[model samples]
Target: MKEIFQQYTGFIMLFGLGFFMACKHEIPVQPAPENPSNNNPVDTGQPCDPNTVYFQRDVLPILLSNCTMSGCHNATDREDGVVLDNYANVMATADVRPGNAGGSDLFEVLVEDDKDKRMPYGRNSLTEAQIQIIQTWINQGARNEICGTSTCDTASVTYSAVIKPLVQNNCSGCHNNSLASGGYNFSTHAGLVVAVNNGRLVGAVSHAAGFVPMPQGGKLTDCQVSQIKKWVNFGALNN
Candidate 1:
C-alpha cells in the first residue's frame, strides 16, 4: 500500500512539471500604419518671371552671340548707319509702339517683306519668337542702362576672344597686309594695339568724328561692344 501511494505522488509531481514546461509566454503584435497624404514629395513653382525684360542678362548676350558676326550687323556692313554694339545705339533705335512693329528701323528690317529689305541678308529672317522679344522690349519703353547700374564695376574680359576676331574677320579684310584701309593694317597684334592706342581704330567707328563706320556701314551687337570695352578697360590683354 505504501509503495503504490509513493508512485502515485511521483506521477502527480511529474505531470505538473511537464505542464509548466510545455506552456509559453505570448507577445502582442501590431501592424505598421501608412501615411495616406504624402503621395508626392516635390514642390512645384514658377521658374522664371514672365514680365520685366532683362537687358544685360538676356537680350545683350543673345545679340552678341548670334547677331553681331563679321559679315552680319557688325560695324563692317554699316547698314543703315546703325550699330547695335552699344547701349546708346540700341536704345536710340528701339521704339515704344504698343503693337506696331514698324516703330523702329531695327524691327522694320526684321519684319520686312522683300528679301533685300530684310535683315540678316541672304539668311533666314529673325524667328517669330525673336521678333516678339524685341517687340516686347520696345513696348516696355526701350530703357538703356549701362552696367544696368549707375556705378556697377564691369566684369573684366580679354581681347583675343572679343576684339581680335572682330578686327580679323571684318576690318582685316580691308585693313590687312595686302590692303591697308585708311593707311592702317590690323593684321598683327602689334599693329592693332598701335592703332587702338593712337585712337585711329576707335575713330573709324565714331560716325561724327572718324574716317568711317567700319565694314563700310554694318553695326556690331551690344555685347560685342561691351566685350571690347571690358577688354580695353583691362588694358587690352593679349591673352
Candidate 2:
C-alpha cells in the first residue's frame, strides 16, 4: 500500500513538471513597441502667419514677377541703375526708404499714373493686391525673412487655378511679353502652349537634361512640380 501511494505521488509530480515546461516553451513572446517620434521627425516650431508679408516668399516672388525682365531690372539690363532681382540689389539700386512706401522710388514707379513711364515698360499693370502686398512689405521695414509654411494639394489642379498663378509668380518675370527670354512668353495661355508643344515647359520646369532649369535662384517644391505636371498631363488645356 505504501509503495503504490509513492508511485501515485511521483506520477502526479512528473505530470505537473511536464505541463510547466510545455507552457514555458510554447508561449510566443511579444516585441517592444517602437517610438514613432524617433523614426520620423516633425517640425515643432511656430506656425507661419498667412497675413504676414514674408520677404523670400511674398516680396521675392512679386519682384521676380513684376520686375526682373530682359530690359527691366534684370542683372544684365539694370535699367535706370535699378536692379530688383535680389534683396541686396533692390536695397542698393532702387530708391527704397524702408518703412516709407510713399517715399520709396520703387513704390512710386509702381503707382505711377503716366502710362508711358508706369514701369514694367509696356506690359499689364500690377494687380491692386500685388501693389498692396508690396506696400505692406515696405511699411513693415522690408526685412529679408523666410517663413516656415507649406501646404500642398493636387486633388483638383487646373490651368486657371494652379498653373497660371504658379507661372505668374515664378516665370512671368523672365518670360512675359516684355521679357520673352529664349523666345518664350508665359504671360498668356496661347503663349504657354508654344513651350508645351515643343516640350520646353515640362523639361524646363522639371530641371530635366539639356533644358534650362526654371525659377532661377531656387527650384520648385515637389508639390509645385507635381501640380505643373498634373496640369500638363491633362492636355495642358485652357481650363
Candidate 3:
C-alpha cells in the first residue's frame, strides 16, 4: 500500500479516520461481494500469539486505528511531532526504545495516568490487553515482524473473543456514543446487531457494492472478513 497501512493489520488499520467512518449515516442497500482479481487472500503464516508481537498484525493496527486519523498522526497531520500511520514513520517519530517499554515514548504515553498526556488524546483509553500488546512488542525489541494467520478458521466464531475486540480495536473510534459518526454506536452489542440485521456488518467489510469499502486507506485480509461473515451467517449472537 502507498500509505503506511499493512495488508495484515488491514482489519485494524481499516478503521481509517475522517471520511472512512464505520457504518456512518449512509447505510445504503447491501450488495453482493465483488470478485476483484487482486482481492484474493494472502497466506501470512501461523496465528499470532501474545508471546510474540508482530508489528503488522499487532502494533500497527492500534496506531492506525487510534492515531492515524486525519488530524492526528497521518503524514498530513503530524500531531506533536509524532507520525504513526506506518511502521517506518512510527520508528522514526514515535520515540520507541528498542527493548525498553517504559523508556519508549510510544509505550510510555499509552500507560500514562493523566488523560491529557495519554495517547489517542480525547478518546477512551485502549484496553489493558491492547496496551499490553504494545508493551510486549516494544519490550521484545520492536521488530517489524509480519506474523499473520494463514488459515482462517471461520467455524465456531464467538462474539466475546473475536468479534467484540475486533470492533473495539478497529471500528469503535468513530462509531461509539461519543462520536456516533453515522448515528451508529458499534461499541455496543445492540448497535452491532443492528448492522448485522441490516447486512451493513457484512456488506461494509466484504466491500460489497453499495457499502463503503472500509479500512479507508487499507484493505482487510480475506481471512478476517471471512471470520466475520461466518459469525454473521451462523447468527450474530452476543455470546
Candidate 4:
C-alpha cells in the first residue's frame, strides 16, 4: 500500500508540472493595437488659394454679399452700430486686426458655433471658400489692396465679362433671387435688363437723390462706374 501511494504521488506531480509548462510556453503574445489618433492630425484643408487672397477682390465681394446687404450692415441700416460699407468702416466696426484672423471679431462671428451669434443672420451661411478667403485676408494683414495689376478695360466692355461680374459682386447680394430687396433681382440677364431700363440701376449706383445708394456698403470705383456707363451707352447688350 505504501508503494502504491508513492506511485500515485509521482503521477500527480508530473501532471502538475506539465500543466504549468503548457501555460507558460503555449500562450502567444499579441501586438498592441494601433492608435488611430497618431495616424493624422486634424486637417482643416486649404480653403482658398493662399497667394490670391486679396481684400478688395476676394474678401470685399464676400462681405458685400453676406454682410452689407440691405437692412443689415448697410450705411442706411447700420444695424447694431455696425457699418461694413467701406474699408475704413469695416476696419473700424468689424474689429479686424492685421495678421490675426483668430482674434478678429469679424472672423469669430463667421465661424461661430452658435447660429444665433453667427453672421449673415437668417441668410444662407457663407461657404468654406468664402470664409477662408476672409480669414486669409485677415491673416495676410487685411489691407485694402486690390487684386490683379491689370489696367481697367473700359472701352471694350461686354456684358458677360465686365457688367455681369460687377453687378454679381457688388449688387447681387441683396438683389439676388433669394433676397430681391427693393423688388430687384440681378441674378439673371433678364432681371438685370429690367433694372437697367428703369434707370434705377444707374441712379442707385450713382447715389443720386431719391434713390438708395446701391451696394449699400461702398461706391463703385470710378473705373467700374465708367465701364458700366459705357456698357449702357452701347445698349447694355447681353454679349
Candidate 5:
C-alpha cells in the first residue's frame, strides 16, 4: 500500500508540471519595443484662415509675384501657353477649379516635386502661408471677389508696420535669401534702399513705363500704392 501511494504521488506531480508547461506555452509573447530614429515628420503648419483669404487681396499677389513675373507665366512669355496675368486668363489656362485646389493645375505646379514641371520653375518656391492662401481661395470658390473690408491705414503707415509686412508677404518669396530674382532683393531695408535709389521700387509698384510692374501676378491696390508713395516721399525712412 505505501509503494502504491508513492507511485500515485509521483504521477500527480508529473501531471501538474506538464499542465504548467502547457499553460506557459499557451500564453502570448509580447513584441519587442520599436527602435527610435531621426526621421522628422512633415510640417503641415496651421490651417489657413478661411475668413480673410480673398482672391484679389491674398491669392492674386502670390500668383503675380511668383508665377506671372517676366519670362515666366506672364502675358509676354506665356510659358507652356499659360498666361496668369489676369483673372480670366488664369482661369482659362491654369485649369483652376473652384472648391478644388489639389485638382487645379496652378496649385499642383506650385507644389510639384519635379523641377522642370513646377510653377515658378528655376526660382524660389512659395511659402506655406502663400500656398495655404491659394488653397483656401480655391476652396472658397476661386471668385474674383475682393476683400471689401481691407482698408489701408495710410495715416499711421510706417516702415515696420506697413512696408515691411508688404514686402515680406508680397515680394520676399523670390526676393529673399534664396532666389533674389533679377538680383533685386527686397527682403531688407538696405536692399529696398538700393532699389529705391535706382528708382525701380517706385516705378515698379506704380506700374510706370520702362519698369516692370512688380508683385508680378497683379498690381498693388491703389491704397497700397498711395501708401508706398507716401513712405518714399517721406524720405523712405527706416522708422
Candidate 6:
C-alpha cells in the first residue's frame, strides 16, 4: 500500500496544481491619474491663488485676446452696445462689481454659458485658469493695481514679455519708422510715447483727426491697448 501511494503522488501533485490555477482570479490594470503639472506643458510657473488674481497681468490679457474683438467690444464698433475697450469700461457700472467675481459679467459670460451666451461668441471657450483668474480678480476688489503692490513683491512683468511684440505685430508694420503713418511710429518706446503725446495713439486708432485705426483692417485688442497703457504708466520701461 505504501508503494502504491508513492507511485500516485506525482499525479496528485499535477491535479492539485491544475485546481489552483483554475481558482486564481485575473485582475484588470488601471492607468495612473494624471498630475496637472505633467499633463499641461504650458502651465504658468507660479502657483495660482484664489485670493489674489493678477488683474493687470493675468486677467486683462484674456479679456483682450478673447472678448474684445473689433466688431464686438472695440471702441469703434461697440457691437451689442458694449464697449470693453479699456480699464474704465471694465470697472464701470455694467462690467464688474469690485470684490464680487460671482456678480461680474466677465465671469458670467465665460463661466455660466451655453456657447451662445459665451463672450468670444463663436470662439473656443475660456480655460479653467483664465476663469479662475477673473474670479480671483473680482474676489480681490478688482482694483486696477498690480498684484503684490501693497504687500509682497508683485512680480515685475517685462515689457518685452507683453508689450513689445504686441506693438510690433499690431502697429509696427504700419507705424514703424519705415512707415510712420500719421507721423506715428510705434516701433520704439520713444515712438510710442510720441504718438500718444501727439494724440495719435489713444482712443480708437481710427479716431479721425483722420488717423486710421491700426493693424490695417483690425482694432488693437483691449489687452494690447491695456499693455500699452501699462507701459506708459510704468514710464515705458525698456526691454
Highest lDDT, which number?
A: 2
- Candidate 5, 1-239: lDDT as tens digits: 99999999999999999999999999965321121121122222434334756556676667776776667788888888998766667777787877788988888988999988876787767777778888887776766654334445788778998998788667876687767888988878888888888889889988999998877555787888898888988888889
lDDT measured at residue 177 in model 1 versus the true structure, 0 to 100 = 67
lDDT (Cα) of model 2 = 0.76
Question: Which model scores highest in TM-score?
Answer: 3
List the candidates ranked by TM-score, beginning with the highest. Answer: 3, 2, 5, 4, 6, 1
Q: How far is candidate 4 from the true structure (C-alpha RMSD, Å)?
A: 17.4
TM-score of each: 0.37, 0.68, 0.75, 0.61, 0.66, 0.42
Candidate 1 lDDT by residue in tens digits, 1-239:
99999999999999988877666323432221121122221221333345755444335444543455565545565456565654444544333233344666667777888998776565545457566777675555544322322322246455655577666544554566655656777767777877678766665554336456654434444455556666665676688
Tens-place lDDT digits, model 2, residues 61-177: 778767775677888988888988767777767776767889888888888999888876687777687788889878877666555556677878988898888888778867877
Ten-residue segment with the worst summed lDDT in candidate 4? 32-41
lDDT of 5: 0.74
| Span of ten consecutive residues with least summed lDDT in model 5 | 32-41
Write down the lDDT of every candidate, Cα atoms only: 0.55, 0.76, 0.74, 0.75, 0.74, 0.59
TM-score winner between 2 and 3, please give it. Answer: 3
Model 2 Cα shift for residue 83 (angstroms): 1.7
Lowest summed lDDT window (length 10), candidate 1: 32-41
Q: Each model's RMSD to truth, in Å?
A: 26.8, 23.2, 19.6, 17.4, 17.5, 18.0
Provide the clashing-pair count of each candidate structure.
13, 0, 3, 1, 2, 2
Clashing pairs in 2: none
